[model samples]
Target: MSIDLSIDLPGLHLKNPIMPASGCFGFGREYSAFYHLDQLGAIMMKAATGTERFGNPTPRVAETASGMLNAIGLQNPGVDKIIAEEVPFLAKYDTCIIANIAGSTIEEYETVAAAFNQTSDVHALELNISCPNVKEGGIQFGTDPDMAAEVTARVKAASNHPVYVKLSPNVSDIVAMAKAVEKAGADGLTMINTLTGMQIHLPSRKPLLANRTGGLSGAAIKPVAIRMIYEVSQHVSIPIIGMGGICNAEDVLEFLLAGASAVAVGTANFQNPFVCPEIIEALPNVLAQYGFSSVQDAIGKGVSVYE
Candidate 1:
C-alpha cells in the first residue's frame, strides 16, 4: 500500500515528519549534496540571534556513554545574514523553511522575528527558548511559564509565520510549559530540547567541556523526550514537533505515536549525513508492518488509547 506521510501544522504542511534539529542541520547546503534537500519535510536552519555570536569556548563538545554534550551556545551568522544569504540558498529547494531564532533578551527576540516577518521564504518560526548551552536567553525563557508565555506572545506578534515554541526538558513540569505557550498563542510546540549534563575528564581532573556543562543529546535522552511529548500532548491543543535521540524510522514512528505531529533528527546527522533519507526510505515498510497507510493516521494513536 502507498503510505502518505504528509503532516500539517498551523500554517505549515510537511510531506513527511522527518527534519533536522536546528543546530545539527546547517542551512541545507552541506546536506544537499547527500540527498535531495526537498525530499524531507522541512529544513530547520541554525538558531539565529539578533547579532552574530562566536559561540562558546573550545572543547565545547564532549562524548558520553550513548550521547554527546554540546555547549555551542547558539553560534550563528545573525538574522540579517540568514535572511540575505541562507534563506535564499535554501529557497532553491522544495522543502519548507523553519527559522529557529534565539536572543539574549525579549527585544532581541522581537527583532529577530520581525526581521523574518518580512520574508516570504520562511514558512515558520521555531523559537529556541530552551537552549541550555546559552547563558542569557535560552533556558531562562523556557524554564519559566510566565517568561515562556511572554516570549511566545512577543514573537507571535512580530512573526508573520507560525511560531513554534521549543520547550526545555530541564523544567519541573513540561506540561505546564507547553500549556503556557499554547495559552500565549503559540501556533505549535517543539518538545524536549537537550537535557543539561556534565562530564569529567579522568586525566585533567576537570570538566570535559570548557563551559563545564552542556546539553546532552542522542539515544540517551530518547525516553525522556517520549515521556515529555506524551505529557505535553495530553495537556495542550497545539501541534507538537517532537525531537530527541531520533536516529531511525522506528524512533520517528514512536514519536508520532506519542503525540508528535512531527519529529526532528539531531546528533544522528553528525554520524550519518544520510540518516534522514534512510529513515524516510524505510518509513513506508514500517508503516505497513504497523498496519498504517498514512503518517497522519498514526499520530497520537498511543495517546488517544491511554487517555
Candidate 2:
C-alpha cells in the first residue's frame, strides 16, 4: 500500500508529514547542523511563554515504564527574546516554524499571539494549553472546555496566523474540549498532550519532581495519544497533529492510519535527534509495504466503526 506523504496542514504546506516536536528539538540550529532543515516538513519550536521562565529544579525529569515524566515548567526565554533570537535563527532554516506559545494568564496569551502576528517568519502558532508540567495555570486552561475555548478564542482573535490548539490528554473528555475549541474558531488541533503523572522515590518516599505531578510523555503514551486522535478526528473537521510516543516510520503510519494529517516526533527526539529525518526517509518504504500511495490516503483507514 504505497501512500502519498504529501499533506497540507490547512494554510501551511509541507513536503512530507513528519515534524520535530517542540521542546525536544531545541531551537533547531543543532538539528540543522546534523541535517538540512528543509528535509523536515515543519519545526514546532519549544513552548515559549509570555515572560522568560528559568524552568524547574534539577530533578525535573523522571523515567516511567514506557514513558518519561517532566516538570520543565515551560522553561522559555520569553516571547520577545524568542522573536529577537530564536525566530531569526529559525527563519534561516528552510522548514516551516510553528511557534508554540504559552502564557500564565489569558491576557498574556493574547499578548503573545498579537506580538507574533506582526512577524513575517512564523508559519503557525501552537497554543501550549496542555502544559501539564507547569505549576500555575497552563494546564488549567486546558482542563476545562470553557477555559480551552476562551483561550483559543482570545488567541485566534489576537492573531491572524494559523492557530493550532495543542489538546491535553489529561482531560476527562478531550472530545468536548476539542469540539469547543473547534467551534470557537481554532484553525487546527494537536491531540494528546503529555498525560499528568507522578513518581515517588523508594527510600525517600518523596515525589521525583519537586513540583510533584508532571506530564508523562514518550513511547508509553502513544496508545493514549492515538485514542485521543481517533476520538477528536471523529468530531472535528480541522487537521490533527498526533504525537506522544511516535518514534519511527511505523509509528508515523499508525498516526496517519488513525486519522492524523501530520505527526510530531516528541520524546523520540531525545533518544534520536535524527528521528524526524529518519521517519521522512523511511516513510516511502513504509508506504510501499502498506500499498498506499500518499499519506492522505492512509488516514482513518484503521479506525474501528460499528456504524
Candidate 3:
C-alpha cells in the first residue's frame, strides 16, 4: 500500500506532513536561495505581534548540551510590515504560509490574528504563547489552562484563518492545557514549544540571556516533545503540529509515531540551512523503511499505556 503524505489542517492543507517551524525560517525568502521553495510541506512564519518589537539585547542565544537557550522576544517587523514586505515575498512561494502570531495581551493576540486573516496571503495562524522572554502574558497564557483557553476563544472570535495554538512545554499538566484550547474551539494544536531553561556565565554569576531565562530548543528537547505530543494527541482529537528539537527526518518519524498529525522543524534551521529540504526528501524513505506508506500512517502508530 502507498501511504500519502498529504494532510489537512482546519483551514489549511499541505502536500506533505512536514513543515518548517516559525522563528526558524526567515519569511521563506532566505530559504528560497538555498533550496526549492516548494519542496517542503508548509512555511510557519516567524512570530509577529500587532506592533514591531526591537527584541532583546545581545547575548540572546546561549548554547547548551544538545539544546540552546534563546530570548529573541518575537522581534519581528510587526504585522503591517509583514503585510507590506514579508507576505508579498512569501506569497510568491508555492507553499502554505502559516503566520505565527504572538502578543502580550488577549487583545494583542486577537489583533494580530485578525490582521493575518485579512492579509489573505496567510494560510493559517500559529499562536506562539510559549515565549518566556516576553512579559505581556505569553508564558502566563500558555501555562495556565484557563488563560490558554481564554486566549484561544478570543482569537477564534476574531480570526478568519484557522488557529492552531502552539503550546508551551513549561507547564505542569500539558494535557489539561491542550484540552482547554480544544474546548475553546481551537482548530488545532502545536505541541511542545521550547522548554524554559537558563544558562549563566560562571565568572559573572549572571544569566546569559538579557531576560534571565530563555526557552531551550534543540536536539535535547525531542524526548519531552514526543512525550507531550503523545499526551496531547491521546487527550484531544484535533490535529497537532509537533515541534521541539527536530534535527532530521528520523526525528520527523518520531513525532508522527508519537501521534502528531504533522511535525515542525525549528532549531535545526540554524544548525543546517538544508535541514528542511533534507527532511522533506528523507521522509518518504523513512516511511518505507518503517513499513509505512506515508507519514499519515505513522500518526499515533506507537502509542501505548503503561497500565
Candidate 3: C-alpha RMSD to true structure equals 1.4
Q: State, as a TM-score between 0 and 1, how close model 2 is to the true structure.
A: 0.96
Of the candidates shown, which would achieve the greatest TM-score relative to the real structure? Answer: 1
Output the lDDT of residue 55, model 3: 88
lDDT of 2 by residue, 1-307 (tens): 4456778986678889888887888889788878888898999999888889998887888999988998888888899989999899888877788999998899999999988977789999999898987766788999899999999998999997989999988778989999999998999998778889999999999999898988899999999888889888889999998898999999988898788999899998888878888889999998778877888878887775323
> Of the pair 1 and 3, which is ahead by lDDT?
1
TM per prediction: 0.98, 0.96, 0.96
Q: Please give, for residues 1-307, the per-residue lDDT of candidate 1 as tens digits.
A: 7899898887678999899999998898889988999898998999999999999998989999899999999889999999999999999988889999999999999999999987898999999999998888888999999999999999999889899999999989888899999999999999779999999999989999999999999999999999999988888889999999999999998999999999999999999999999999999889889878999999889876776
RMSD of every prediction: 0.9, 1.5, 1.4
Model 1 alpha-carbon drift over 4 Å, by segment: 304-307
**lDDT for 54 (candidate 1):** 91
Model 3, runs deviating above 4 Å:
1-3, 304-307
**Which has the higher lDDT value, candidate number 1 or candidate number 2?**
1
Each prediction's number of clashing residue pairs? 0, 14, 2
lDDT of 3 by residue, 4-30 (tens): 888877777788877788888878888
Number of the predicted model whose lDDT against the real structure is largest: 1
How big is the positional error of residue 194 in model 2, measured in Å on the Cα after superposition?
A: 0.4
lDDT, ranked from best to worst: 1, 2, 3
